[model samples]
Target chain A: MTVLEFDRITKIYNVRGAGQMKALDEVSFTLESGRTLGLVGQSGSGKSTIAKILTQLETPTTGRVLLDGEPIPRHGKALRSYRQQLRMVFQDPFASLNPYHSIRYHIERPLQLDRVVPADQVDAEVRRLLERVRLDADSVIDRRPHELSGGQRQRVAIARALASRPKLLVADEPVSMLDVSIRLGVLNLLADLQREEGLGVLYITHDLATARHFSDEIMVLNQGRVVERGPADEVILNPQDPYTRELRAASPDPEKHFATAARDQGGAR
Target chain B: MSDALLTVRDFSVVYDVDPPVAAVKDVTLELRRGEILGLAGESGCGKTTLAYGVQRLLKAPAVITSGSVVFHDASGADIDVNSLDAEQMRRFRWDKVSMVFQGAMNALNPVAPIGRQLEDVFEVHRPAMSRAKRRAEVAELLEIVKVGAARARSFPHELSGGMRQRVMIAMALALRPQLMVMDEPTTALDVLVQREILRQISQLRHEFGFSVIFITHDLPLLLEISDRIAIMREGEIVELDTAERIWTDPQDGYTKTLLSSFPRLTGERGVVVR
Candidate 1:
């Protein structure tokens, strides 16, 4: 089933004196349940604009976003309901979390505001969510954002996003700021969550390697248009577009290229 | 290779917090003339701290406990960067050693034109140069970094992230400094733009004959661009070897794990190997 769909979405930003900037032009795609759609693009390539349109942070200049075969309302109770069903995870963990609030408050505030559970049971639910994100509830429940590592903070952010049990997750460059050692762990966690919770995810990133590793379907965006869209492996391995090929070639691979160079130089000479 | 441009010997940085956390511990490395030494590690591995310590860029509450950052001047005099006073350090910075920081896209003054920023670098380092000479030099610098001279008239917000980074590099290279410290110089850019920037840096290093201290968490990028690689873990330098060796024969398990964790683009088909 199509959990979320963007039908011919177009967003234009107009400066005071400058002409309109076409951020997203006639972009159309569908996000099904229990699947991830990876959006790859360079800076200013309309990936973030799509995320904004879906989250209702910004309305599209044209077209509409449908949730479960119905158009999302512009205002009133329906809009709030749509927002509650879709949650966003920002790129920077440091900026995403409130520095002053403890982890418990950060996790529990969303639950309380959304009225996910009774007031007294909010604490227990927060603890369970923390555990679900693989964080030790006892050690991290009272700690502030500053006290935790980047990986831990991101996990907490994920837990906070999952607090209200949203069906769709819009993670924008979620692992770009993290260390490589822990990046895979987070990606694996997201993959596992999608499988277990049947969540539909729109993972936006510029890193094609991670997109190939994580997403089931991939869309290559350049200049606010979809250049190619197919299975993640096919799009990565046999990319038809010149931009996708260039992006693939530009990605650094230490094991293959470096090893080839080493062999040619007779083992670093 | 007779005279090393920058020598970091037994360097250690400690954050004077409640537990007195050590960020960089007993790290030692050397950068020869015209060579690029890449520092590769994950976040919180002290690579940035080491970069700041080399140029004495650390703020208060962060203390350099031991060792020295010695730079060999053009006249063959060894100067300890850690011991320099505020005024001396100011003169040493940008003139002798400059840094192109991470997220250099946002480093520019949003309101100021790019030409003025480039001119500011020249004005601080070469105070004797005339206005005409500075303007001409700014154009030349921008051209060398592949950012057209026309962009010098535009504001920071008008330029793309890659263009902004090129402008930052142009500004850093304006003085022809002996050593340049780049911390994740290409992280803010896309893969193709990153390649272009790295290729420009490689070519410029060959032409300018200046050593580079490159810090980044991307191991494969470091392997591609660096002559030597230093792997840091926790707070210590776990392994330091040639980029080729670090790729094929890493000495530390942490380094090995980091290399393995990277997702390769060209590999076994249809398998999500992480």
Candidate 2:
């Protein structure tokens, strides 16, 4: 079933002298439960606008966001409940986490506030959340966010997101700030969690390489429009849009790209 | 293979803390004239420390414990960078060697227009130049980075992040130094912007024939751009090899792991590369 659907969503921003700016123009997509939809775009491509509208941090000028076949409520109890069902992970893990709080505090607070588990069972749920994200619950439980590595801190952030048992997760460049060596471990962890929990996810990133690896379906955003959308491999390997081709060219995989270019030059010779 | 433009020998830097942490340890490397030498490492691996140590840019608690940095000028004279007098060092910095510092995009004076900021470089280095000459040079430099001369009058806030970075690159190239030391220049930029900046740097290097010490944690990017790459780990140079050799047959276990860390779009998906 489709957990989240964006139906002709359009967002217009009014500048003092510049008139109306259509940040997202009739963007339509559906994210099924237990699936990942990757939004690939460069800066100022309005990728974050979609995230904001879904999270209800910003309102769309036109159209609607449907959760489980129902239009998302705008205010009061319904909006609060909708937020509990949807969670977000930001780009910089360091900025999102509280340095003063312990790991247990970060995770347990969410569980308690959301009442995801019974009061008596909150501790067990916190432990499970930590361990589920592949962090050592015992050793990591007492440490502060600053004490952990970039990767570990990110896992803690993921754990906090999972505490509410969110149905749809909007991870915005979730692992962009992490070291390359530990990036895959986090991606793999996310992939594994998506499999086991059957959660729908909107994975937003500037990196097509990671997007191709992680997402089931990919949508290429150019100047706030869906320029291309298809299965991950098809979009990446056989991209139809010129912007997608430019992105593929700009991706930092030098060996394969250079080798192909060299071969092409040699063949022409 | 070409003549060494700069040579660092037995360099070490130690922070004067309680335990006195050695941020850079007994390291040695060389930059060939007109070659792009890459320094690759994770954060706190002392790659930045090494770059700062070579140019005596380290401040406060960080002290150069040992080493010699010799710069071979075009006139075949060996000048020790370590023992240069204060006045000589000041002139030597932007004239002989300039550094594009990390976050240099935001390093421009917030209150000043880009034109005046560009002219400030000439004001300090080439003090004899008239106002007209400085304006012309600034315009030419802006053109080199493709920012156009109109942007010279605009504040840093007027330019986009990529444009700001291009302005920084233009400012760094204002004096046309023999060597440019860039520390994590494009780390904060998105992939496309980073690619464009790297391409411009490559083109500018080709046009001017100045050597570059490009430092970054992204090994793949380094492999793509550099003639030689030095891998640093825990303040030590673990492996130094040609970019081709480093990519094809890396000797160190750490280098191999670092290379595998980045996900490849074309290769086997969702598997640990090692």
Q: Which structure among the candidates has the greatest DockQ? A: 2
> Per-residue lDDT of B52-85 in model 1, one digit per residue for the tens?
8888899978999998888989887889888899
Compared with the true structure, what per-residue lDDT tens digits does model 1 show for residues A1-269? 54788999989999789998999999999998789999998877899999999988899999988999899998987787778789998999999999989999999988987899999898899999999999999999999999999899999999999998899999999999887888988888888888889999999999888898889999999888999999988999899999888788788876567667758888753
Best by TM-score: 2
- What's the TM for model 2? 0.96
Instruction: Write model 2 residue lDDT over A85-182, tens digit each, in one string.
Output: 88998899989999999999999997887788899998899889989998889999999988999999999999999888888899999988888778
DockQ of 2: 0.54
lDDT by residue (tens digit), candidate 2, B116-190: 999999999999999999999999999999999988899999888889999988988999998999988998787
* Highest lDDT scorer: 2
User: Where in model 2 is the C-alpha error above 4 Å?
Assistant: A258-269, B272-274
Residue A166 CA displacement from its true place in model 1, Å? 2.0
RMSD of each: 2.7, 2.1
Model 2: colliding residue pairs: none
TM-score of 1: 0.92
Off by over 4 Å in 1: A118-120, A259-269, B1-3, B16-18, B74-90, B268-274
